[model samples]
Target: MAEFESPIVMPKLITFLSSLLQRAAESNDINQSHQSQKISVFHGLSRPSISIQSYLERIFKYASCSPSCYIVAYVYLDRFTQRQPALPINSFNVHRLLITSVMIAAKFMDDLYYNNACYAQVGGISTTEMNFLEVDFLFGLGFNLNVTPTTFYKYCSYLERGMMMLQPQINMSESSLYMGISSKLHLSFNEDESSQSHHQQQQLAV
Candidate 1:
């Protein structure tokens, strides 16, 4: 099995993931798809002022979970969005959704991770709120937290392809990078997911 990636890779992963998410949320904001959307547990009364990249950076720097947790958390978010298509990833709810997703992913994927209270602190919400988010999110996911190796590989492959597709306008102002994923998840991929441990540090995405 391949060894885990060096800790040096975390920042780049964080940066790349942030850019992709920011773009997704912005696109959703423009669509404003669910104008009559009922307030779900993930929605905030108002959108947060913090940019998506900065919010993700705060979680990465503070949550400090294994590098793979970021990717796993992203998978969780995709699942959640699929499970609840009415509630897309928009600016208003993205911050809370991020904290909740990352927290759950860290718990499921990491042997050692901070508690909900700690995650809440990092996410600028109360521990009670974090707890609520977790429960609601789990139920939203129908309690499916286990990410199969095949599924993980498929996501990584698609993200890399998406990055390649969007490679033109990529500013990459920061030296850091990690990878891409989706707001649009229906795309097909030709990668062989029948390879590698999901926990192994992958060169493609975290």
Candidate 2:
């Protein structure tokens, strides 16, 4: 079995995936003309009600696949983007793409996984559509699903570094907010704020 990622990393993955889906939604909203044409061709529907973060957390809780599967799915998403730059991730298609990539990753990386129907239910789609997505996605990827450990860890390393980079920005943002509040309350700024911010940053860094 593939190893589960550290608890710290899983949330980072979740955040990253959710952001990608949101960006796709934003891109689709901004480019209405392209979206209409693409939707007509693919029979796409309006965006789903569920948030990407909630959907991913549901899959993580129920799918029972290792964190490695999610990592691989990330790789697949990247590869799909590279291979089909014209067909970018968007609101109309992001949900299907997310489901398809994770299912493929589970099948490729895990010994046992649920079938199309099960995954479809989890993804809130019909089995027929799931099957269609699986086949189409496989062809689009040229069936290159294999991922060596070295490549996998490289991705993990990149994600870890990204998490590290994100922490300071979050801390600074929060610190700035705290400072603004403290100033309104007639509290002193520099020393106390700096120490409190540093402490909070340390907690998140871990």
Candidate 3:
């Protein structure tokens, strides 16, 4: 079982993640790539007004999952996009994708965690819709949820690099410690994926 890293102690990681996602959401919003790419269930009719950073902080404050779950969730989203290149993370669908990915990551990483209805409430979506997303996410990823140690470190390095892009002066070696990846990859993905995210497969991880 994966040990949980409480949210209270992970404000830095949360902020770093929020920054990266904020950039992606804003850039994707301007481009609106769905016209050229494949659209999936995650494309909302209207983009939610809340900023991606605020929404992510809300999830961090409320969902109470471990910090590493955020990283693991990123990995899941990246894999999902790799397999389903059509639906990248745009503003239209980032929140739903985020909540579902975090919730599923929580299920796989934490021995004790929230149920679907509770997660649905936190995610600001109906339980029915959350349930639908869960199944579709699993299918979209083809149940390839397990992450090897190598893959886990790869993602941690990727995230650190992304953070470095936003903060160029930061040293890469120190950035790893700054992002708090100095420790082991705290993850265990037994459950299948459940979420939304996109871009070209190459841009998926942000």
Candidate 4:
């Protein structure tokens, strides 16, 4: 059975971030080419660091988890990266890593148990791949599982309340406005000042 890991220590996190930044700078100079090259650059730099953050953001956007849970997940990912220097940080692998980390973290903080099959389906990886990665991830994290963040429940509750408050204002059937908000939340495209102003005008009309 998989177990929950302890929260990552601080000094290790700092070291990991430092290394990640250095790698990101090096990746920026490399010319983009094939998928492998892109993966190499991301693994060496951006994806490792950003994946945790992005994953946390995505989970919080949908789940009622606290920012603290996300923070703990970030810390775990960072520490694990520091210790497992060989782990890939490319787009594909980074996503896999993030999913694995979050699953472990949820168990630690929320007392939730996530199955490999769910992770495989969402991550588009085979169950064998997920199992392999999970083992590698567990080893990287030092088997110190015992994380219990204080904020996840509270944040989730707050989000629920906020959504409830907004429900009356949102017409679920209206695709355009719903799409606009969703786009903004996902940072899919840039919204300039004029766009923001226009959105405000539209809101006032409603």
Candidate 5:
């Protein structure tokens, strides 16, 4: 029997994961190709139409699986990448990978998950494709699905670090925008003062 895990920690990890997947989906091929050069099969796959963020949010909104499912799915993804360097997550196949990883995770972590056909509908892929992807993904990871509590929290801490790194970039962008607005406001204030001075001069002359 699979170990029961808590879902409480999943939300924060999901947020971190959503950001990471979005960045990965939007990344160019140069770096990804270099990383997964050995996985030539991925090069032939077509990119999904939806953005990773939108797709993940859709899953979160509609999927019946608990939050821990996503956290476990993230672990599977990391392990898969480590085990299969050639098949690293890239834009071309990221959507399929996300769907497969989460579905497998749900099956492993939550005993009451929907089957591949149901997941297929959620993923916008056919049942056959879903099954194929599941098999391929499992083989890719060598079926390493069991995550201990300690390992789970360790993964959580890694994601927390990633979130911290990302937050600063966001803050910096917001700070720059605030400064731009401040500069514009200051210029507007200077113009207002100049206009008032001109009016005062006119009043004095009159």
Candidate 6:
């Protein structure tokens, strides 16, 4: 895996996967498709939705980091969809997919305190099952796990300070609003930069 010194530039991967997730969510209600196979690992189990939510909450609580880990996991899920068009669009395996993605993301973003067994315990899956799912997910994601965000909270803080300095007369409420808007705009700029970088890399590769 390439060590991403900069952040991961993968908006194409994110957009593609978001579409897949939407399609998967939709398919659960309507027609059944082969894309369902990719998600079948999530089926015939306990309360999958509740389980997924719990897993996410635990990740945030224990990871004690920015939502960057969550975002990276989501990007992994999305990237998987791009590679495997036959993935199932159902809730059956959504949690499994989410856990697998988070596991990979955690490993890449931070120290590996939690192993496959730990994830299995938290996600309510067997050790063997977790291992299998991890392998499957890794293969789908092309084993590329390095993902960081350029628009970190530090950047937001700097911009907020600049805003405050520039507009000293602004009241607290207005300053908060300005900070919020600036943060959002910064994130959008980061996304655009990542997209442009990816495009350039692709062009160079060709």
Clashing pairs in 4: 4-145, 4-146, 5-145, 5-146, 6-144, 6-145, 6-146, 43-89, 64-156, 66-152
lDDT of 1 by residue, 117-172 (tens): 99999999999999999999999889877766556555565544444445536433
lDDT of 4 by residue, 78-175 (tens): 55645554442434355566667666665555545457776666555588877877777788779745432212222223323333344445322222
Candidate 4, residue 105: CA error in Å? 0.5
Q: Which ten contiguous residues of candidate 1 have the minimum total lDDT? A: 175-184
TM-score of each: 0.73, 0.71, 0.75, 0.43, 0.67, 0.55
Candidate 3 versus truth, CA RMSD in Å, comes to 5.7
- Candidate number achieving the greatest TM-score relative to the actual structure: 3
Q: Give the per-residue lDDT digits (tens) of candidate 2, residues 115-186.
A: 899998998889898899999888777886765443454455555455557563532222221222222221
Off by over 4 Å in 6: 1-24, 27-29, 33-51, 58-66, 148-206
Stretches of candidate 1 above 4 Å error?
1-8, 33-36, 161-206
In candidate 6 the C-alpha lDDT for residue 138 amounts to 87
Model 2 earns a TM-score of: 0.71
Question: lDDT of all predictions, in order shown?
Answer: 0.68, 0.63, 0.68, 0.42, 0.60, 0.50
Could you tell me how far off, in angstroms, the CA of residue 123 lies in candidate 6 after the best superposition?
0.3
Candidate 6 lDDT over 1-206, as tens digits, reads 12111122122222333444445656653554432443345444543556434555555445443334544565566566666656643556666787778777766665434788888877767999889888888887687554334433333233334344544464333224223333222122334434433322221111
Clashes of each: 3, 0, 6, 10, 0, 9
Q: State model 2's lDDT.
A: 0.63
Error of 3 at 117 (Å): 0.6
lDDT of 1: 0.68
Comparing 4 and 5 by TM-score, which wins? 5
Better of 2 and 4 by TM-score: 2
